[model samples]
Target: MDKNKFIKDNFGISDKTLKLVSEAEESIKEQFKHIENICEINQLRVMKAFADNRVSDSHFVATTGYGYDDLGRDTLDRVYADIMGAEDALVRHNFISGTHTISTALFAVLRPNDILVSITGKPYDTLEEVIGIQGEAGNGSLKDFGVKYVQIDLKHDGTPDLEQIKFTLTHMNVKAITIQRSKGYGWRPTYSAKDIGALIEFVKEISPETICIVDNCYGEFVETEEPTAYGADLIAGSLIKNPGGGLAPTGGYIAGKQKYVELCAYRLTSVGIGKEAGASLGFNRQMYQGLFMAPHVVSQALKAAVLCSAVFEKLGFEVDPKPNEIRHDIIQSIKFGDPDKVTAFCQGIQKGAPVDSFVTPEPWDMPGYSSQVIMAAGAFVQGASIELSADAPIKPPYIAYMQGGLTYESAKLGIMVAADKMLRKE
Candidate 1:
């Protein structure tokens, strides 16, 4: 069967939107051409890292106690470090989530008297709790630990507020500065690697001693360059989000300068038993294979994000970083303006999922977030954003966050289903 027919039969896509999807076919192909260049550059980098680390079939075997001399784990860390152009890296299966890895890094380098500044406005929701910006400060947050936190909001045009950054850097005894490359739940545009590089240069010129860390969850492999290549002191991301290729069960990674990475490792394990102590527990094969496939998987997701933006824009809804704009992350946001539309859109997405298709999603008070959120994630692996998923918060303007498509086809079909349902209501 043809692509359009298959979509119509399977997802019940409307005739009007089917034409829109068909019209978008050529444009999606054209956009993917640019993505091919990005994938090509990143593929070469991944291959070089693997080759330099001498990755072999034997490296896939797991180790048990203490994991000393675990070649697979060591090589994965080395390859990650090399690909990011970092001095060293600490990649392990022990770090629970992206927030855990980021928290470890913060606690490692920051002291009670030293200040931590975020120049990219407030960070993601979970980071607010971790940084002590919300919730109880008694949960051993940075604020409770006596580490001062300051944030600089972006300008009206959505660029970083540089004047405030300079003022903060010149006066405060700032220990580290954080740049969130992804847009998170905000409506702001995602920062490209080149843009992040400029920010890194600006910070260095003001205070060369300050550590610059990037929360690099959904931004990996979307561009040929990464924040680490542009002189970020440290970068952190979750394996389940991007680097896992939708295969890693659970984990996160932090890669950067040898001293900083070592500090994070020390915090992850112990001072004397840093990276050498974590057991691979039979996940070496998936982690290694996942890294090898990450570039291709990330490209698929990027194409889907562009497609989502285009489709939503055509439907008279607001979309951030329109389809034709330069993209640095896979997330695409669309404003629906009504709670009923939000529910219908999410249910439509869930209906197209490969798993849990019979279930319905509803808004509820989810932890780590201020608002009630409804999430539709029917992934082969639980909570894997690298697969097709959509989420939204129950608040004013009612925007839905869509991200991750393991394959471009899955993402395309899912969006068509949601758009069909949403447009039918009109």
Candidate 2:
């Protein structure tokens, strides 16, 4: 069957939703132009130099540290620092996952009894076990080290509660404050780098001495500026999510002041050794290329999100495409209000996956989450692949959270397919 007819038969999408999709695509194109301009003006030279050097080949030699002088690694460390606009940056292909990076950073900064306040409620589901909420099913994390955990409430509007944040800082013995920029478990309200900066300012004013850390995964390259621009003491992130650009096989990054980076590096590699001596098996040259193309690629994803939000809203589903003006990035969530429709929508998107395809939606126990019945159809071998992923929380009101597309074409196709499926069900 033809694509349109197939869609009409399986899912019903209205003409109004289609029109909104077209308009959103146009807006996305305009945003892409702006992104291109920014890259050309600011990062093109550095990117070009990296491309000319073919830095990926030197990965083994550069990271070997077997017989290399410490001076060379130290110099490269300074260079990375300059790239991140910080006193120091440590770029290693060693951090295996986002959790690893966060764990290392926490270990570096927090003492055995130091207090750690999560300014953004509970963290992603994967962290629940690590943070002491769940039992010792997984690797023992920060909670295992005897650190105190605190959570501050967010305001009704979804931003952090400034007054409560101040109360926590003043009353609690908070040694470190962590702000997760992206939403937990693949659901994020479009937030930009500048928004992160504002949050940093708020924290600094209340407790200047307390260490401020930001989980910058899924947020890199989405905005022109970065969290470090606003004074984040340490920013930890996954390369595969945004900066990796679908190029790196797997890895994470930590950027911040030299002292903190050194401390984290020690924690990542060991108390005495650093990542400089670790195996380079984790870093991929494709990741470097992906990072170069990320700004434009992410712009396309954002466009898709905006378009999808408009389409879902027109179709009678409550939608929040741009929750806040400060949030200016990708990620669109649509409330299906029906479990079956949410499943069908996910199926439709999976059919359009670039890498692989499958449909097995069911309820299973996910660590760190009280909610049950989570479903995901992702293209990547690991769940981090955002090429096309849409899942909904199984609660009273079900909403499918969707984001990530390699290109505007695929993202638009996925949205159209899912819309068609929903329409057919109706």
Candidate 3:
């Protein structure tokens, strides 16, 4: 009762809303143990990587200018590679975003006339233009550069079409295949690390020369193992998403085979300046510290996601990864089925934010997406997905993809606040 009062008084949630949330949480408590188990395994792996890399205070030294021979920058790369179980990694605060990092990796692995296969069907919305599928010509996109691209749609059950993939491999001179481990903007279940590994193996058997790259975005550190552990040639992701633990202001990472990482490094910088020139700009410590805290923070976000599923399921809404289902990423997809409800839900999320509680969010044409979007995020770091935030395309079905929670407590309040606004309208 006292806890309910605290939530009601502080967050302005009605008692009815609180009761609903409380009931939702009680039903989902069993899911927390599984999340914690994965967290523990990943936490140990990260610690082991840090220790094996012999990290010291000197590795935190800031660098400027050409950033030549910067121990901090280079050692951090080694640490990241170790964490991902890859031969090498190019970790820098310089890579713009997850999409930017993935683009670089894609460009590095493929040349003109080489065919690129997306085994995971269409990628995230931002990558559409980057892949030259939905953008103007002569923009230096892959399509502009004469690189061919194809995709194999997942079956209705959300499983890969192995026969189609095998036939495609045999018929086409495929150079590389991209595996998006997370379900981006799609209602499909996120692929598990083991599941990804099986797919990589399947592809390798058919075409040993074809490189396999995993879009390791929101899926990072969620499972006990990364795709690299299962024989991925390369993996790319945004630091601000999961590995940052909500502390890294900005950046991205690409880790995998040494040759691919080295090529990506060349693309990130210049040919010869690869992995050697980027200045850490004093962000090394935050990166290091954030990574160390990632597992625990991810667990919190996972808990929040699970709770969202449980609450919305109880409310008779359609949700992917039904309550108590194992999560491969932090994202919780809730189908509200109405644009007005989507706006209200996001606005309520803003009100629950620590940074901008007074603001109301409205839908707008966000860059890199096809539809006008409504986003509810008031994070300390702009565009930081690891903090509590939600965004929806504001189109048919009106599904809201909510993710991130620095701490479970804050995320719970945010969910409660969003629920209050949603229920008030009903």
Best by lDDT: 3
Across 63-143, the per-residue lDDT of candidate 1 in tens digits comes to: 998889988888888989998888888888887788888999999899887899999998989888888899885899888
Q: What is the lDDT of candidate 3?
A: 0.90
Off by over 4 Å in 2: 1-80, 136-139, 185-191, 282-284, 323-329, 358-360, 378-381
Root-mean-square deviation per candidate: 1.3, 4.0, 1.1
Ranking by TM-score, best first?
A: 3, 1, 2
lDDT of each: 0.88, 0.66, 0.90
lDDT string for model 2 (1-426, tens) is 666455445545456546556665555555456655754543554464355444544542333335234333344445445545567666555667777778778889988898988887667666666667666733666778888888875666777777888888888778898888777543335346677678778877878878888887667665556677778888887766666666656677788877888899788776666645554432434555565566666656665676677667766887766422233445567777787777787777776566555565565666546786555555553665445577666775677778777777877777877776677677
Clashes of each: 0, 9, 0
lDDT of 1 at 381: 82
Q: Give per-residue CA lDDT, model 3, range 89-194, as digits (tens).
A: 9988887799999999999878999999999888999999988999899988999989999989999988889999999999999999999988888878799889
